[model samples]
Target: MSSAPALADDCRFDDRAGLLAMSPEAFDNGPDEGWDALAERAGCQLEIAELFTAYRQQAKAAGHAGLAWHEATMRADAGQRDPAIALMRLTYKPHGADPEGWNHYVDATIAFLDDDLPALKRARARLAKLPMPLGNAREQGDDERPAGRPQLKIVDALIRCMYQPYALASESCPEP
Candidate 1:
């Protein structure tokens, strides 16, 4: 909290107009944490966390997996590591239909937040080596992704995030 964190392009949370203008679909679909990071900079995570928690519950009740992870991430940003990890383990059950690399990504994320760099590195290596999902196993942005390892950017970003707090680094992560 020394100074407000900025996005890669140096956007600061002096105001929340753009963030507030975003639709729910935009928040859920955005790969970047710009909105949440700005919210944190604006001291808005308390309200945001409540919304994510409710969304997590609905997602869990409906058997969806992603929103639980979302809540866990917010908790991690808030430095509630134990609860974050526990909620991740409890709510976001991996499905048979998920990509192999996705499982490793989850491990990487949890380990990163847990301050276990060795485990995070191992998971990143595994993710880097994973073959492209054969047919329909591609995640949303995979279609636009160049033909190569997928999701490595996110792992690298998590590593860079180690230089500072996840709350601050998440916004500044250029790879995201």
Candidate 2:
């Protein structure tokens, strides 16, 4: 797969004011053209991939869950499900008494992949009951708090809910 783009040598969104002024709309305006320009200006897949991965990891650590997820999701290989599934599993693992949000994530992922109305409906129902703090924060444009009680609880719950479904699905469909 092609790696993410690198920033231009003269790109000047280095400060807070510059960042704030940089609208998300700009990114959305012409992604392919922008990426092509960036690729042309900064030539090196390794450098671009490293920069993209670093940004994604930093976003995750900084509670910018939406950005982190978006980065991962966008780069997911079309024929590869393992990485996506692994990510879902990691996000929902439980820590203590609480259930993580793994279940909701898994359900959502399955719904996204399957395109089955029944599965989608079931996933949506389960999702409605889950706290889904990270999902909620992303929707509200609020940064997720560092991993803690609420995060753990949601993660655990998600894990529990998704476990059986994931297992069953995997069993039914072996990877080639």
Candidate 3:
């Protein structure tokens, strides 16, 4: 069996302490490669994956999609097949007919996990085609991206992390 990839000393996704010390913007602006490296590093921590799964079960029981998604991501980082498939399905399962921008986001996430560069690009283009938030209003320090667009930022961060490794490092934050 293949072993997990080695991580640099500064990679913050290795444990709760590092994760806590990190800022949210890191995931937003950090190098795409860093996200990838984190995921690769996660593969070596099966114990952490199990904990994530337990947390996912709790989140699901509480009907918290956001928390479930986060835990699912941790599981996915450990190369858990169920979480990867479930993550895509959960994102795609909601919203029938006109899926708004979710289709792009879901597609982008799947492509990222699959390492399909072309598909990821196409999905990102589709997402970009959607109207961006109006005006350059002052940024809020809140956890969410904005109203009516829950989890978009998280999805983008996950996508960036899944595809590349060891890019210019930036800040990140705990999932709110």
RMSD of 1: 7.1
6-105 per-residue lDDT for model 3 (tens digits): 4545333455544323343342235652233344443344444443344445323344344344444554555654666575566454555434676677
Assess each prediction's global lDDT (C-alpha) against the native.
0.61, 0.40, 0.48
- Return whichever of 1 and 3 wins on lDDT: 1
Each model's Cα RMSD: 7.1, 12.9, 10.2
Give the range of the ten consecutive residues with the poorest summed lDDT in model 2. 167-176
In candidate 1, position 150 carries an lDDT of 47
Model 3 global lDDT (CA atoms, 0 to 1): 0.48
Query: Between the candidate structures 2 and 3, which one is better when assessed by TM-score?
Result: 3
TM-score of 1: 0.62
Q: Ranking by lDDT, best first?
A: 1, 3, 2
Q: Judging by TM-score against the true structure, name the best candidate.
A: 1
**How far off is residue 35 in model 2, in Å?**
13
Q: Over the stretch 1-176, how does candidate 2's per-residue lDDT look in tens digits?
A: 23234455443223423322333433223464222233333223333333334544432344333433333333332223455445444444344433444455555664544434466456556555655555555566666544323433333333344433332232232322
Model 1 C-alpha lDDT per residue in residues 39-129, reported as the tens digit of each score? 4344444445555665544433345455566666666666677877876775433576556567777788788877888898898998888
Per-candidate count of clashing residue pairs (backbone under 3 Å): 0, 14, 10
